[model samples]
Target: MSDARAQAPETEIVDRNLTLEIARITERAAIAAAGWRGKGDEMRADQAAVEAMHDALTRIDFKGKVVIGEMRGSEKLGLDEEVGTGRGPDIDVAVDPLEGVTGCAKDLPDALSVLAFAERGGLLHVPDAYMEKIAIGPGYPEGIVDLDKSPRENIETLAKAKGVPITEIVACVLDRPRHASLLAELREIGVAVKLLPDGDIAAVIHAANSDDTGIDIYMGSGGAPEGVLAAVAMRCIGGQMQGRLILDTAAKREQAERIGIPDLKAKYSAEDMAHGDVLFAATGVTKGSLLNGVKILPRKIVTSSVVMRSWSKTTRWITAEHQR
Candidate 1:
């Protein structure tokens, strides 16, 4: 692991302050996400998360910008935001408020509020298009698996490389109607499938941190905002992931071009997607997947997050006490 404490002066100053700021924002989001736990309303849960993040960003002492954020007025909720339109460090912000609303509603595990911050033009502002994604834990060769291969083939290949059996490998997919066929296919291959109601960021992080979650792979199309945030975590954890935009229509294609994405089929690696030093923080909203959810008491709320720095390859587990 790189010594995050020993970076150059300029890098150190920016990274340290950014990490602290992200930690605070994520902590607030955790409390907000918890309020919607078991409410059975995903939208309200997500709104609460976004509101907390908005409040936190406004208070931070930085000239930040929202390169990617909750869609809100846009058709999509987490993509399609104008750059430099929101408050805070002239920096880009990517967030998934209440990443797994269904999980929170059902009290499932691994739901979190995920966010990534970078200097302007650092994070990819991918269009609200499907992305063919494949990822693995650290130390695997690049390009080992592409989206074109069969799910079984990819799983077996990854398992072989990791020296694990196919049966032992666990894959995560969004528990959606669109994934019905994909889920059935994995079942036939004897690979264990961990279907999540929401929160691909938690799934991706689980794949990246194999030791903690035992999720060997993450395959499926999820929110573009979550993908960008996962890219930041992958960079810090030395994992490998590739994503290609899946445009459903010409309007979406035009949006891609508007954001300077020349090739829709181009593959984005962790470094390619998160192009510079980044500060990432994710607070658990419910008791599932990666981290535990917030616990509210009479006088205070307890929140947890996994904050990471790409430049330093440092990941910190933070717990904060907030007054009610």
Candidate 2:
């Protein structure tokens, strides 16, 4: 099995704050996507975000390779595509231009624009596939949870580790049909399950930011690219996560093999997904837990964003008022 942790990033660059620049990118995307909110067009909203994010990224000076991006179908920012103006450090980029298309279209909560920056090979490049993920916030003993464990066991163990009852723990999960049995198991164990309509990346962040949200863990399957993006945030915000690609089909397995992931069943740690110096930025497209969505005013637009840097363990909440 190939480990992505080996090619970790070096010390931070002194030139500029990359996290803030990336925040602008997400801000642009969120603003663009917000224009279509509640218009009931998912693809149009996604396209608006993708185009704006691509334009913002290309205008930047860094040399970036899209390690994790919109898979096969999207017109821009596909895997392995080179971006930026090619004038600065060589880095890996992972992005989800619009995280919750459905939510955004319906004017629901937590629609976001997100991306991560890491050193070359600092991110695990996986094919477009579903990933089985398990995550928890910081301050826990290593190896306390595993993907192979049932929800009951994981929740009970986490509750005990925290010296609390199972009812006190809250686990976030996608409200999908596939999770029916898992939901039943969690309910039987008395752990509250927070059902998310979309945005598993936010779900992971919620789990990582347990002090504020009380989300003890996040489990279930989501996009492999989003898994990498979430892992980057964990590196900065402090968390533990594990993911395994669900390459059940022959085509998916072959694609994984082609991308150097020979061990189809190999479980990857958060560090394995993003091991080096990294930055993560996210801007809300709709009002949600982590941030307030873009607000359009008569004379300006306001955006709320969170930017994090791994080396310094700094997390900043930025609010920008752009003249209209």
Estimate TM-scores for all models. Answer: 0.90, 0.95
How far is 230's C-alpha from truth in model 2 (Å)? Answer: 0.3
| Position 122, candidate 2: lDDT | 92
Regions more than 4 Å wrong, model 1:
1-9, 12-16, 74-89
When summed lDDT is taken over every stretch of 10 residues in candidate 2, the lowest stretch is 1-10
lDDT of 1 at 251: 98
Cα error, candidate 1, residue 84 (Å): 10
Candidate 1 lDDT over 37-121, as tens digits, reads 8878877777787877777776766656666777544233344344333444467778776677778777778778877888777
lDDT of 2 by residue, 52-92 (tens): 99999998888899989875377899888899999888889
Distance from true position, residue 223, model 1, in Å? 1.4
Against the reference, the lDDT scores of all candidates come to 0.78, 0.90
RMSD of each: 3.0, 4.1
Candidate 1 worst ten-residue window by lDDT: 74-83
Task: Report, for all candidates in order, the number of backbone clashes.
Answer: 12, 0
